[model samples]
Target: SLKIVFNFQAGFGILANMFLLVFYTFIILCYRPKPTDMISCQLTFIHIVLLLTGGNIWLWDIFGSLNIENDFNCKATFYISRVMRSLSICLTCLLSVFQAVTISPSSSFLAKFKYKLKKYMISVFLFIWSFNVSFTSHRIIYSGIFTNVSETKQMKVTKSCSLLSMNYIIRALILTVIISRDVFLVGLMLATSAYMVIILFRHQRQHKHLHNLSHLRASPEKRATQTILLLVVSFVVMYWVNIIISSTAVLLRMYDPVILSVQKFVMNVYPTITPLVQISSDNRITNMLKHIQSLCHHIFKKR
Candidate 1:
């Protein structure tokens, strides 16, 4: 069933996000992340909550065997799931923008506060949560379960819940704001990344005479930066693909269950791929794994 597929994807996404959240939290606890790293940590945790909540709704739908046509819980479940999801998207975009700002050049305005307000990171996260909470409360208030016509009467036999037209308009407005934020941050990220690349290229050339073969290649920061850039690119690509698919479905006034199932699957990739990106590029993670392997070998030898 379509519900099963959606549940599967949502479960996968939640599990992946949980892994990423734990990994990052370990990093943060073991060694305090740079102020910028805190943003990523927070974002990952937020995503875990989003995916878990969304997964619960789909799982409930798959198992409840309740008619959406007459079910209040069905409507509330979807409303909450979507609100959490949209909030996650918005928060991730904010994280990306924060990182881009942190890495910007000294001459840039964002750079002015980089070292000055490092203590405000917690407050910043609180603000992000507050924003999302206030923005989506109306979903809890205005949304409700509705009965659809039977298959012979008009639409399909399967029951489903949806927002009313007025609520949908509100959702569109909120989504537009989130989309605008994503676009602006994405543009800034691209510009900042390009600038860093150009600077690194020039530096690599300048240092060619002073360093040996390996040293002449990419610096650690350059490699790490590139990895983070790739992470951003992956997030952006996945987001836009989902947006495109969603937009098409909305415009055609055709909510195909198949496409929704596919969308859920696509959503899982971002969190799963994100951890691998960090692990592959981070010397700390590599060293941690190596340390664990050595410990295992030592214990085995003693046995």
Candidate 2:
């Protein structure tokens, strides 16, 4: 039952992210893409790949036929997934910071920094990719299948590749690195999101007498900022929930299948919802979708 639930969730997540990937790619190709759009496109593309890879692993685990049991395949999937997850958080932070900087008052320090950073956006993206890849290299080295012996004198092979460290000191160091990286990224995302929210609030307050309107309806920048904030909040919530569940499982040394399924479901939630939020908030995508629907309707009417 848990396996069925996981497969269902993974299938839905893959389809959603695949549509997002294609939509963003269309935007990049047909529309004048902003820096934010480019970032979103890259993020969506990564999500699609991650979802496909993750879904395959889950399906394989259920069917028990696909031969992904080798060390190389395990390391590749584990490493790529870890790197992509970290990259997703970093890209989200970049998106929030970019939106915040774009919406900052012209005379503010952020405005100045934004001006300086605009010319080197590609370089910044490259740095993020390199840094995350280098940082997560340890996963490739530490992840492999291991055998465990139960008290009943029965030996079982672990189904999935996981981090294996016999040395306590080495394990501690790895754990420290992983935890610190996650904390730093999550902190950065929260701070940037908070700053953007404050800026939006002040702007709205200053114009309160003009008209009462939601921040999302105020301006394009505000709408984009609000959308990014929503994305960040959802990502952080799901990310931390998965983290907490996994950490608890690790600490208790208990591998409850239901708990693991719940963790994966939580982790997939953000990817599933991100595209929906993006399309709903952006008038261009919504307009494009509507146009497509109308065209199909008209063609059917002619038939």
Candidate 3:
């Protein structure tokens, strides 16, 4: 039953993320893409790749069997998954910061910074990838298949792909690196989101009369800002919950299959929900879907 559940979750996540990737590719090719849209497209692409790679690993774990066994598979899966997961978090943080800067008052320092950042957005993305790859390189070096022996009188051998043993110093270093990276990215996202809220609040207070006159009116930027804010909030909540569950499991040395399955499910919730949130919040995508539906209805009526 758990295996069936995992398979279903993995299948759904992969399909959903793939749809998001295709939709964004269409938007970029057919429409004038904004900086935020570009970032979102890239983020969606990463999510698709991550889901493909990580989902396979989870499936293997669920089945408890593999047709082919190799150390390379273990290393490749761990390396790609770690790098892509970090990249996903960093890209989301970039999205939040980008939206905050976009909504800043024109005369503020953030507005000037935004213009400069826009000029080097590609460079910034390159830097993020390079930094994450470099830091996550240890996964490739320290992860491989390990052989475990049963403690019974009749020794039984079990081969599993996981983190290989290392010296205490090296282990500590890697743990520190991961924890620090997560803290920095999460902190940056929270700070930028809080700042954006403050700026929006002030603007609302200052333009209270204008807002009253046009109560239902919201600019595109405002809508985008709200969407991104919600995405960030949701991501933060899922991230922390996953973190707590994972940390507890690790600290307690609880390696039960059910516990592991729950952890995997928690880890996947954010990516699974992200594309849905993006599609529902963006008016263009919703409008495009409505247009297509109407066109199909008209054609059928003529027939």
Candidate 4:
């Protein structure tokens, strides 16, 4: 049952992210996209890589069937997975900050960032990718094929890849850095989310009062802000839950298969749900889908 559940989540997540990948690419190449859309496109791509690397998708079994397994494969897989996971949080935090600035009033200090975001968005993303890639590079040194299950110093990440123990001081320093990064990014996401919520409320209140209207629908900015808040909330909840389970496993020396399976499920949940949420809330995608459906219906009726 556990295996079945894990497969279901992994399969569904990959498919969802793949769809968004193509959709986002089309929008980016063929049309003018909102700044937030570009961030989301990159986030979507990161989710795809995370699902592919971190979720494993039975790669261990395939490697075994192929009769080829080595430290390089194990190390490369985990290293890429770690980098993608780091990128996930960093990009999500960026998304929240940009949305907050995008929705800020023209006179507000945050509004200045809106212009800078457009000018330096790609540079910011490149920096994030480089930082995370460097930050998690230690995985290459510490990760390898697990040859001895009895070795308590190794923590199993996948069926084949395990993290070898490092020097006590070095391990402690790495842990501190990772914890600091996660905390800082999560806190930033929450702060920006709160700011967006406040701006949204103020806008609604003033909009109603000034227009003498009570049943107004959400504006485009309001919808975009709400979508981002949802993403931030969901990402935070999943991150903490995964951290709890993985931290517990680490404390126990990371030998438990049950705990590992649970951790994978927890990790996959956020990526699986993220793209679905974005697709459903995105008016452009929804309208495009509707257009396709209508076009298909008209052709079928004529036939």
Q: Which candidate ranks first by lDDT, i.e. highest?
A: 4
lDDT of 3 by residue, 23-114 (tens): 88887898888888889988888887776666354645633565544567667777897888899999999999999988888888889888
lDDT of 1 by residue, 5-82 (tens): 556656665676676677778778987677656766766666665565453445555546654334456445655666
lDDT of 2 at 284: 83
The whole-model C-alpha lDDT of candidate 2 against the native structure comes to: 0.77
Per-residue lDDT, model 2, residue 95, is 91
Task: For candidate 3, give the lDDT.
Answer: 0.78
Off by over 4 Å in 2: 55-63, 149-160, 214-216
By TM-score, the candidates rank as 4, 3, 2, 1
| The 10-residue segment with the lowest total lDDT in model 2 | 149-158
Off by over 4 Å in 1: 1-16, 55-58, 61-76, 101-110, 149-159, 167-176, 212-220
In model 4, what are the clashing residue pairs, if there are any?
A: none
* TM-score of predicted structure 2: 0.88
By lDDT, rank the candidates, best first. 4, 3, 2, 1
Separately for all candidates shown, the number of backbone clashes (residues 3 or more apart, or on different chains) is 0, 0, 0, 0
Specify the poorest-scoring 10-residue window by lDDT in model 4: 55-64
Relative to the unseen true structure, what is the Cα RMSD of model 1? 4.2
lDDT of 1: 0.63
Off by over 4 Å in 4: 157-159, 210-214
**Candidate 4 backbone clash number:** 0
